[model samples]
Target: MTNTAATEIDDTSSAFTPNLTIDVGGAPMLYRRTGRSSHTVPPLVLLQHFRGNLDYWDPLLLDTLAADRDVITVDLHGVGGSGGQTPDNVSDMTRNAIAFITALGLTEIDLLGFSLGGHIAQEIALVRPRLLRRLVLAGTAPQGAPDLHRWSEDVYRWATGDVTAPEDFISLFFSGSDDGRQRAWEYLARTHTRQQDRDPESSLACRDAQFQALMTWGIPESAKLQRLSAITQPTLVANGDNDTMMYTKNSQLLAENIGGAQLRIYPDAGHGFLDQYPVQFGQHVRQFLGC
Candidate 1:
């Protein structure tokens, strides 16, 4: 295992630094570690959404979760400071994630994955169930979900049409209500707070690869919904009531299919529901993790 000594910062003021790197499968993987873990409580490993890196996390949410338990956020292969070509499928991405976790000497962890990250998390749990103690899937859906292709296509059109405009995010992540729009601006502001040593923005090629993987996962044959029954760990599935990127019903399906999974759908929110209700969501996660 290899890492830089974690630099401490005032928890009330700034987010923790994420300057550590380790070798995984002959490639460099970058991650940020915060908080301290007790003998009984395991560290929380966070996986980023599509085109996201360590810096993309909501500081309020990340700090809130880290206040009571250790948190580790990583940049997947080829997305940020991590080295290697980006995998075009969830299975390969899961393999690299397992490599990164094992390289860090973490035998057990609580996994939290958002959007695309959630898909990867499910794969990890299925492929290597023993490695995880708990699982959290937010703003995501199961494989081969009905109407997923249409929603993904619409989201893609909106996302690509005005990549430079901040307003585009409002439409993509939040609802049409006034409160949702207000929270969308606040969320945008929070993402820009971390200025130094931030990970690079994902390239167009990376985005294309991610969408390809997403479309493939949407196909009925590639879905592993039936295999989800194999997951026995305590799981928390959450999303907004009006999620357009991945329909809210998928969350219901996941909760129903995954035995004993807890589900929460925030009202008047969209794909970025966690960002909309960070404190409440954090509390829910902390309670579920028993921290």
Candidate 2:
């Protein structure tokens, strides 16, 4: 008698889906899950840039990737709706991420990290080894890259400012070209489509802690590049040709040291190139992820 009761599937493929929460280590961790589930492809977990909350992602990019497979984005401890003190070091951040993943009951998955999140992804891969099936690092650098311990003067003006305006975001993420600015505007529009239940802005404590962690991670130790050999998962390293925030060369360095890692550089773009070329980059990611 109950065989024909509501056969339609629940479609959570939209980035505007309401935020969900789960307890991780006695604290609530906020996250969003999108797209359809696949038996062969693991859910793609995303980590955002410094000072970015779960709502910072471009919805167009998320939906594009979600069309084929599941996508998950988390607020990480103390960063948004998630509860806990923000960690001051990448090691502690990685531990928090691991705890979140474990609480999700996931054994293997894919990871995509942007900027600060990319650093955490690399740490997770090295520390856990077998946890990730694939890795994607965008607009980020490896630890101990020479002269990368601090932000450049021009970059410091916008990235560390008390308030980030559209102009600041344009300067930090897109290229100076007119076309690049147009793309940035479009990407910004897409990110705002979700009108309700948005994650709160990251706190000043989170910003300061993250910056300190970056400084510590970039202490100019060359041997850290050698550590890339430990991560055996298939990796995709991508960035804009002129990423002022993390530098384009860092992406090259990541690809070079990671052994057979693929690299993609978007022309006339900057740190947020992935968002600037959302559809294209999303397709590239889907292809790389084999979704």
Best by lDDT: 2
lDDT of each: 0.82, 0.87
lDDT of 1 by residue, 1-291 (tens): 111111212435235465788887778888888777778789999998887778778777887888877899988788878888789898988988899898889899999999999999999999999999999999998988866665566577766552536676778888989888777777676666666787787777677777778878877643568888998999999999998888898889889999999999999999989988877898899999998
Candidate 2 lDDT, 209-237, residue by residue in tens = 88898889888999999999888899999
Looking at candidate 1, the ten consecutive residues that score lowest on lDDT are 1-10
Q: Say which candidate scores most in TM-score.
A: 2
- lDDT minimum window of 10 residues, candidate 2: 1-10
Q: Quickly count the clashes in candidate 1.
A: 0
Off by over 4 Å in 2: 1-13
Q: What stretches of model 1 exceed 4 Å from their correct place?
A: 1-16, 161-164, 221-223
Residue 116 of candidate 1: its Cα lDDT? 90
